[model samples]
Target chain A: MSLTNDRIKQRLIEKFGEPVSGFEELYGLLSFEAPKEMNLKILQFLFDDDELKFRFLTDLCAVNYPDDKGRELAVVYHLHNLVDNIRLRFKVFTNVQEPDVFTASKLFSSANWMERETYDFFGVNFIGHPNLKRILNVDEMDYFPLRKEYPLEDQTRIDKDDAMFGRGGTIV
Target chain B: MSEHQHHIKLPEGSIEKQTTTLNLGPTHPATHGVFQNILELDGERIVSSEQTVGYIHRAFEKLAERRPLYQITPITDRLNYCSSPLNNMGWHITCEKLLNIQTPKRVDYLRVIIMELARIADHLICNSIVGVDAGAFTGFVYVMEYRELIYEIYEEVCGSRLTTNIGRIGGFERNFSNTAFEKLEKFLREYPKVLKEFENLFTRNRIFMDRLVGTGAISAERALNYGFTGPNLRAAGVDYDVRVHAPYSSYQDFDFIVPVGNTGDNYDRFLVRNEEMWQSLSIIEQAYRKVQEFKGADAEVFHANVPEYYLPEKKEVYTKMEALIWHFKIIMGETAIPKGEVYNAVEGANGELGFYLISDGGRTPYRLHFRRPCFIYYQAYGELTKGAMLSDAIITMSSLNLIAGELDA
Candidate 1:
């Protein structure tokens, strides 16, 4: 039989136990979250496993949740098992203040730039990344732009009102 | 010798610096896009190269978080402008997937035709540009006419050309006009002959073959590890096409081959793209035939029946109350979006263009990340070009089809 979500979940539960939580299949994609420190360990397990040959690193990015205090940032990895034709999402949450997650670049070389991009946008500060500098944004940039704290529009602009724009008002 | 040394008293470290550091581009014509490669070279051979991108970083993902569903299509268009329709379609499909909207058969087939045309246009540019990089400009000049014909077909479907904001959230903004079908028919009747001629010009040409055959080759293993997808992966002999593996927009209904090459070199990439153009043509023909088989009312169906997201007719909006309210709600971005996360990918001209969208029942996405294939695989450029000749690096970059906008976005 082809690798199903239950089977993958079973394997992860077998290996990582209860720490691998929030298993849900939405829009046919199986998603689960793990502890921030176990990111590389899980990635390596997924790569080294015989049955779960999720070799292709489809995408890597970060999502910011300003309200989720202890876990303010989520680094999402989209891994594809080309042989079984299954895709899964693995996420690890970290606090914004110390957002240091182990890098996956050692396992997947493509993750080098992606991790850099994540660091640039969300300030993930991937630990042990070979060149963990900004990939897309300029180096002189101070704050992470994609974080929810940073609004898309300029705060200093006096002409436009945020209330009229329909997103809750910050306009004078 | 002592008198000559005294006459030209060189700096202490001048003779020890054996390699030259050359900046390939941020604006060089040969680089094709706004990308810079700082190459450490030993004479004409590259020692090690470092690439610096993000010249056109438009903060698209950040912008996407604020825009509603329909407004994001134009942002996708700028991702891979060479085949903007494909990007537009990919984004719309992502939205549709999140909303759980089912499209009609005619709309699916219509999408297939436009998307296949886009694939052909994209492959034409990459392959012909490969020829140009290899110093064969005639093929580029010849194939561009057909690309223009393809553009005319796009013009008939959508109003614009290059960065075409083509399709809507669920389907096309309008139906395919007769002129569009005629233009497609004209292209179909004429393009095969031109493609054959293009192939004849480059496939076996001694100079073109020599420049591309073995240079800049990446093994299938490395290509996958480096996240290579679409033609670049196919060129390395892995037939992992998004259209074939995960069929979308009625792609499973059509019959087409996923053409692959053996070596993963510049020549293989060129050949793979060229063969894919042929496959795209065949797929377009099948979709067109399937579209024609739709009888009566089915023929007129273009967009899906999702009034909540899709806009009503302008005349109806002006005349009727409900249409006006719906129109206003959609324009004002007040439509209720479902709370979910969905990832949708399409076989773009170069690679797999994926949209990872997360919506928290908000007007805009909670977080939206574009899995631009160019950006993912472009990290391999340093490895791909290491120890190769400077000119071959140019060929490899063009063969890789790295779009700067997509890369930096």
Candidate 2:
């Protein structure tokens, strides 16, 4: 029998209790959230469980939520089970001021560069990462560019026409 | 060496062996694209290495946040520039999923043809470059000529060649021209013979085999742990293909084999890619035949019936006021997108090219993240090349087919 999202959710809830919450089914894929501290434990459980063997780490990325106050950064993990051909998304949000989530690099080696990339973009510092420095951005860059706090466009550029870009401006 | 011997005149216990640090290009031909690897070498064998990417980092994900759904297709072209149509289609599919647009059967079959052609084009470059890295230049030149043929097909379909933003959100920007079909037919007839010849040149060559057979081999466990996908994972003996598993873009309609290899080495990657090109050819032929079965209006139905999202016809835009208004609105990013989050992945030539799109009923995406296969696979470079010769490392990298544009995006 193939694994279902309900069974997986029940297992997670039974194991971690109240820490695991926000179970959602989006586009037929199972997605849920857990406390930031229990990420490694949840990942370990998902990998070690016989029925729920989400062994393949499909992707690791972070989403910044500047308006969420305490929970401002979300570290998302897309895991896949090769046996049943099932995919699950697990996310853990952290405070932007103290974004310290445990690294999953020990369990999934793919998380090494991904964690570094998350740090490079959203400034989510992964605790216990061997090399947690910037992976994509330059080392000298001080600010995390992907954070909502930063502007999407270059603020210093002055020789530009807003009207050409569909913004309201007097024609030449 | 004499100077070191004079300076270290103490006992053997007191002397420390120093390994040479070699920088293998952010711009070297052997490295393919702009990727720098600082290799710690003990003679020819590599001790340790650090890869520095992002020389071509354009912050695509950040840029996607600002651009509207339609405008982002061109940006997707720059990523995996070899098989840009796949990226373009992948982005369009994500938008379609968000907007709940159902494409026609003809559109799906048409997409399959273009996507498979792009896959073949990408694999040709990768496999040919592997030959080039192994000091076999003839295969590279021979296969590259066919890549130009594929580009001509792209030009016929769309106006551009390399960065082909071929299709629209609902379907193609325009219907396939007669020249396009002729070029595709010519390619189908001629490419197999050229590919066979190219394979014969390197498949049994002793020098090429020796250089690649056991070099940079990664175990399936290690590969999966590193989040490997597409050919790299298949080369490791895992039969997890997105097209087979997920079946996007009507891939399930056509039947094809997923080629896998025992050892995930440079040679296995080469073999897997070669077989995949053949499979892609078969898929394209099937899809093309299916597309030909359509008659009259059914054949002409390329784009879906979502007039709000799809641009109006040029003639209609010139003649009708409603057509002109719809065209203007669609081009100006005035079309309303549904508020939802969808993650759509396509089996790109490299791996699973995924677009994680979140929309909040805005003209632009709330957040867009591209799951680039090159970036994911390039992470395992240090593990793959460790304890291997410097020359072997070059071959391993080439076999991985790490496109810097995709890597640093």
Best by lDDT: 1
Best by TM-score: 1
Candidate number with greatest DockQ: 1
Backbone clashes in model 2, listed as residue pairs? none
B269: Cα error in model 2, Å = 0.7
Per-model clash counts, in order, read 0, 0
TM-score of 2: 0.95
- On residues A1-172, what C-alpha lDDT tens digit does candidate 2 reach at each position? 8888889899988889988999999888899998899999999999999989988888889988787989999999989888998889999999988999999999988888888899999999999999999888899999999997785666555432233334333555
DockQ (C-alpha) of model 1?
Answer: 0.69
Q: How well is each residue in B234-272 modelled by candidate 1, as lDDT tens digits?
A: 999999999988999989998888889999999999999
Q: lDDT per residue, candidate 1, A105-135, as tens digits?
A: 9999999999999999999998899999887
Worst 10 residues of 2 chain A by lDDT: A159-168
Candidate 2 chain B, run of 10 with poorest lDDT: B8-17
